[model samples]
Target: MHPFARSLVTFAAATAAAIALHAGEAAARTPAKPTIAFVHGAFADASGFGEVTSRLQDRGYTVVSPANPLRGPASDAAYVASALQPVKGPIVLVAHSYGGAVATPAAKLVGNVKALVYLNALALDAGESNFGIIERFPNRFGEALRTRPFPLPDGTEGTDFFVDPARFREFFAADVPARAVARMASAQRAVSLSAVQEPAGEPTWKTIPSWYLIGRQDEVISPAAQRFMAKRAGSRTVEINSSHASYISQPDRVTELILRAAR
Candidate 1:
């Protein structure tokens, strides 16, 4: 081969090898991301996580937002665990509001949930019921709440709890856009009263590394209660100036915290 041509070929080979080596190093440094599973709370569904889910999906995350059975804590957790069982890999389980009460137990059942990310979510301790913990802190949540009785499958009666749509914006999402809050209120799902009274099982936050995002302006769940729970569970906590609708109003912050737990 001509001397110049031979030199050019040698340079090309070196460049190719260098590029391959860099790619290998990059791959080695980046670990495979865990699946992110979300559990929605009462008065809402999985679609409430639209912005956060979209952001995570855009970043190549495998996301699962399962419908939480609003019957009660134990039942809800069992359903969530079963839904995520088919996902093969580690999971960073995230929950909001009442869903937090469900995620802890579900994570324990799923067994591969590496971290718990709470977004203004409940972090119930063993033997603590939803209403039990909330009563520990003073809040105006009760003012917006409404309840009704429904006939159960066994022919007995069950009570369903809901936020009065007229007052939803004031207590649930004061900071969110009025239009958005209206939509949320209209589509809200009711949680059985038994759910609030049922005691939580052993908490998964006890064993897993957990992250908590507390909303200072949350009228539903008091920020003081959030701090108390996060501190007790030894979670890495960040407080934001948001309402109970923190995930909806501050999707970026919410997603950042989840990513931190995920990484």
Candidate 2:
């Protein structure tokens, strides 16, 4: 064979081998789509994650948005645990607002949880409740809504706590349209005060690799408090310019974060 021909043949063989190795590595590194369990925050049910869940399902992910009892963490955690029991694969637990509190104990109940995605969610330390965490910070929303009487039998009070159609647009769902916000507020459930006051026993974020979505314009939970919680949890933070109901305001960004964790 000619020397030039031999050199060309050698180069071709080397390139083929490199391509084969790269393909193998790529196949090996590809991760399965994790079962994503979404937990909604105070005053909201599973429906709050409708848009986000639909987006995730479109991408071929197994999505579970469980309806929390709006009870204290212990009871709500039990509900979350039961919901997770049917999942047959790895899980990426995603929580928003008060749902973050529920995710703590629920994540512990599930053995296959791979990561946590918090959407302006609570990140409680040991023996800390949502109220306890906020107590340390300045609470404009709490102060404003403190005077408004809770219509529910159980005296829980907050702007986003009841989900009035008029107030929802102004406080939680300002970015969303009137009809959607009206529907959301009409269907909203009242979270128990016990849930807010009850402290988390063991925070799951402490052990899991966590990611946080910070709602920069959040009024319900202070953006400052969100930052503090995210930092303390050692989370990877992404900011969205939205109100307390950021998942509704920016479903795409929220879905993207969840998908990142699923991978």
Candidate 3:
């Protein structure tokens, strides 16, 4: 064979090999099924993300809803960090309500997180808390809840707590099944007044690619407030016509948003 022709053939073989290797690396980096870590808001446990989790899992995602202590953001973030420690691939951290406060700092602790999904979730600015935002705009729901408080066994004020079954269904999760709403009401946790009062240091949404699900019918946290937070976070927003518990009321939409972030 001519020397120049032989060299050309060798060059072509090398180029093909490089292309194949690059393709393999790209596939390896493309996460088989991105892991999704869900953080629930106040008055609920990890179980609150049941519907969301089921939907993600059905679509081939490894979902983790860490049992946050509900103590405060710092502790909750620590708890979530522990849950995130073992994850192997890319992650999409989904936060609902107070869960956003927890996941904000928690996402910083982990390296695998690719994006964040906020479901009508809180998005605090520097040195701001949930209480500060709400205080700026007093709403009927907060006023009504404040009228009838649930004093904790420790004697601390629990004004940020949830209401009973009938109210929970009507206001929070009217679209969810009665039995599920009852279970949620029964499992409701008394969020500390300090939790809302404490300021978030640095919100993660500022640096991360974030997607927000705004509940148009939210009463617990006003729909207006959700929009405000979403704007400040510079998040890609998707509005759902559901209550604050959109994960329960509009699970499919919530699931779709999460999967979008995972992509």
Candidate 4:
């Protein structure tokens, strides 16, 4: 090729490369979509959020349903905080039941958490505990819980609480499909009694913009109790006529509330 022609080709290629580099830089500078980190309540694992997470992911949102240790609020919060460390950009933390307690303290540790979404979950204040609050506003389903002694890591005995499988459907997921409820019961994780009884640290909902979804038919956490906490936290509240497992039975609505918080 002629020298002039070769020079022109080289210049064109260089210009293209620079433009590509600039575009990459600009994309990097542009903020990414905030992640939705979900916390499952006691007697549940991240798998329980399959539908909700999938729907959120399909909508171009990154969703994480971390395992709640169900050890206690402090330790559970620490575990959740560690999970949040690797996540960049804004976060919309969603929790159900006891997970609310974990998310509350965990959010306090992560500045990137911009919103809190509670699905029939606990939203306790400083010096308050899941069990403590529940005690004040007792749910009839509380009578369905079955407890057994379990050995703790330190060799001491601690109580493990689970909704009796026979009553799980009636009290926890009455509105969910029978097949799914059966599966849920079989895979249920027993929450340590000590965990629910421990008091939480400062409540993050006090400062975070929060959204609460009340399951009006929730037997686990009575709707009345849910309202009390939502009102206390000044959360934007929505009521759904569902069970304690509204996120399972009404995942679309739950996901919608989560997206709203992400916004």
Query: What clash count goes with each model?
Result: 0, 0, 0, 1
Candidate with the greatest lDDT versus the true structure: 1
Predicted candidate 2, C-alpha RMSD: 6.9
Q: What is the TM-score of each candidate against the true structure?
A: 0.90, 0.82, 0.83, 0.90
Over 1-263, each residue of candidate 1 has an lDDT whose tens digit, in order, gives 99999999999999999999999999988888899999999888999899999999999999999999899889999999999999988899999999999999999889999999998888999999889888888788898999999999999999999999999999999999999999999999999989999999889898899999999999998999999999999999999999999999999999999999999
Q: Write the per-residue lDDT of candidate 3 for residues 108-176, one digit (tens) a residue.
A: 888778899999788888888888878775566654242235566799655555565457777667677
Cα error of candidate 3 at position 64, Å: 0.4
Q: In candidate 2, how many Å is residue 228 off?
A: 0.4
RMSD in order of candidates: 2.9, 6.9, 5.3, 2.4
After TM-score superposition, the amount by which residue 203's alpha carbon in candidate 4 deviates from its true location, in angstroms, is 0.8
Candidate with more favorable, higher lDDT: 2 or 3: 2
Residue 78, model 2: lDDT of 90
Tens digits of lDDT, candidate 2, 122-209: 8888899988877887666653332223454476553324555556667776788888888888787777666788878877888888
* Collision pairs in model 3: none
- Residue 250, model 4: lDDT of 92
TM-score of model 3 relative to the true fold?
0.83
